[model samples]
Target: MRRKARQQTKAENRPRFWGRHAVAAALDNPERRIVRMWLTREAAEFLVPPKDIPVTYAEAADLARLVPGDAPHQGAVAEVERLEDMLLADLLDQAEDGRPLLVLDQVTDPHNVGAILRSAAAFDALGIVTQDRHAPPESGALAKAASGALETVPWVRVVNLARALEEIAEAGFWRIGLTGDADTSLQEALGPKRVALVLGAEGEGMRQNTAAHCDALAKLPISGKMESLNVSNAAAIALYAARAAA
Candidate 1:
């Protein structure tokens, strides 16, 4: 009886994806193991699950109660198992396509990370790299912010970001760290080669050791009055620039 109770607790702790886009994307992802889904009648028509998947019809208030008090569930919610973490080497191994990869350094905010994932998917970047300890776990808030990009993009979490940067460098990617003080503009620094765009946290920016691993450092061409852009906005601009350059 104790073992069964523990199992039930573990199952409940698994991440729950909420909102229309987030739940729809999870259903679409072949790798996602959706335990169950709850949806209102209106959302049910918009997002049809596979024939084999179990679903429950619930009212908006019921869905709201299932998630965090403030979560915007958009009439749907899904209990899902976390995706397997990918190795840094596995991500680097597939670098033949010359796609730009985004690396985050201690950017702990779930919303920023999710927004970055959205931009990464938009630009068709290879994937996102984050430190295992510093990053947030997959959650409903993140999935909501990603707006379906969470399922589409592969997020790689590594033990040591600086060392991972070394591996990225070794993998033929020219790591470009974005900094406000950098002498070169992002446009001028980017070249016709595989690139890795490294961004740090909001206030402190990239750590010194992390910056040291990069091949070059550059800054966005923004107004001098502004100290720095939000991490997500910066990621979007960087991705757009990288894609445009490519």
Candidate 2:
């Protein structure tokens, strides 16, 4: 019995994915080359496809090494290839489909960006537009928080956000700037067309010039209880409002 356990250990010792959703989604992707899987005994039996994908039973602590410290891996893990990035032009061209595009200007927090990506995917957005200088990269806790949303959403990073706004305007998108202090309510100001929701950092909100470039400035109708909502929270609310109106 001990030898059998040791043999199972040997088979399971390979690198495994630790996040359930990430691993589950990765397993679904034909592009993902999952090498191995490690699951808790109960979790092992719970997964479908009969764990036929080369799995080993593992203790929870053993799975921690693969995922971040705070992650809820749910006792399942898999090793997979990194996902790919989509070109900005491709994202732009796809805008013809009529879904609104989301533009982020200098919003640097990875967690916030990740949350926003999740929101963007939920809203059926065309893609996420971010400035190359300000946005976070694909890793860190950001991608993990985004979960599978990061893989699904196209992130376009441009050198100049102000200039990019100009390009978006040229593409016939109604650029709506979201701000806390603006006088107008977001829903009343928005047009039902291909829109580009321009957002910015939390503390600073939209930069003066970034705000200036927008075709219109809109504000979320919030009670004057606090100074501001977290950028991602505001973005989620705004995206929901837009989708509801559309």
Candidate 3:
């Protein structure tokens, strides 16, 4: 009974999650009940508090106290609930008429997706589309990589990617697949219309049908020096190129 009681007490102090991105993202969630947020002087400056939730100012050591031994809290800590999942259908329905979408074929790495989310959000992307079967659930490292973009970016996971592409196409999106061996370059092929940038797992690249279903397949004009850019990086550049075309 005593050991169980002690364990429960520690659980309360254990942060809901670690790293700045996770905590910052959690803070932005309307559903998150931020009882008290601790931030170092440096971290405190950048955060804009909503009118409702009260904030706390604490030292860097205070943030360290809340996380694990090796965890880098980046001088901010927020307590929040587990993630909430948004349906792909709902997101598709909500998409605006002209906004571009990004569809991940089967990319499983959370950190990469999270970083891509940051870039997508930076470029004013509509939302992220992923296959439900091959993606990671919300986790600490992913949130960190997202740099608080996890909260801002709506991640829509679908049952079937090919069909999702079909739906997106039916909705008037021009599905563009990014690949290394494609005939045209990304800059040349990006059309002035809604686009769904399809990307795949790192080494294998896009699945055959994923490549086949796209409106067009194009490559980035790298010097062919490196084998390929990371999928997330390629996706980021592709999204940027798409935005530039817009």
- Provide TM-scores for the models: 0.95, 0.79, 0.79
By lDDT rank, best first, the candidates go 1, 3, 2
lDDT of 1 at 212: 96
Which one wins on TM-score?
Answer: 1
Writing each residue's lDDT as its tens digit, candidate 2 over 100-125 gives: 78988788888899899889889888
Please give the range of 10 consecutive residues that has the lowest summed lDDT in model 3. Answer: 10-19
| Residue pairs whose backbone atoms clash in candidate 1 | none
The C-alpha stretches of model 3 lying farther than 4 A from their native spots are 1-15, 20-22, 33-69
Q: For residue 182, give model 1's deviation from the true position in Å.
A: 1.2
**Worst lDDT 10-window in candidate 2:** 10-19
Candidate 1 lDDT over residue span 84-155, tens digit each: 889989988877545899999999999999999999999999999999999989999999999999999888
| C-alpha root-mean-square deviation, candidate 1 | 1.5
- The sequence of per-residue lDDT tens digits that candidate 3 reaches over residues 29-136 is 786556566677787777655657566788888778776676688777666544467776777777664467899988899889988999988998889988888987
What lDDT is reached at residue 94 by model 1?
77
Q: For model 2, what is the alpha-carbon lDDT of residue 104?
A: 88
The residue-level lDDT of candidate 3 at 96 comes to 67
Report every candidate's CA lDDT: 0.92, 0.77, 0.79
RMSD of every prediction: 1.5, 7.3, 4.5
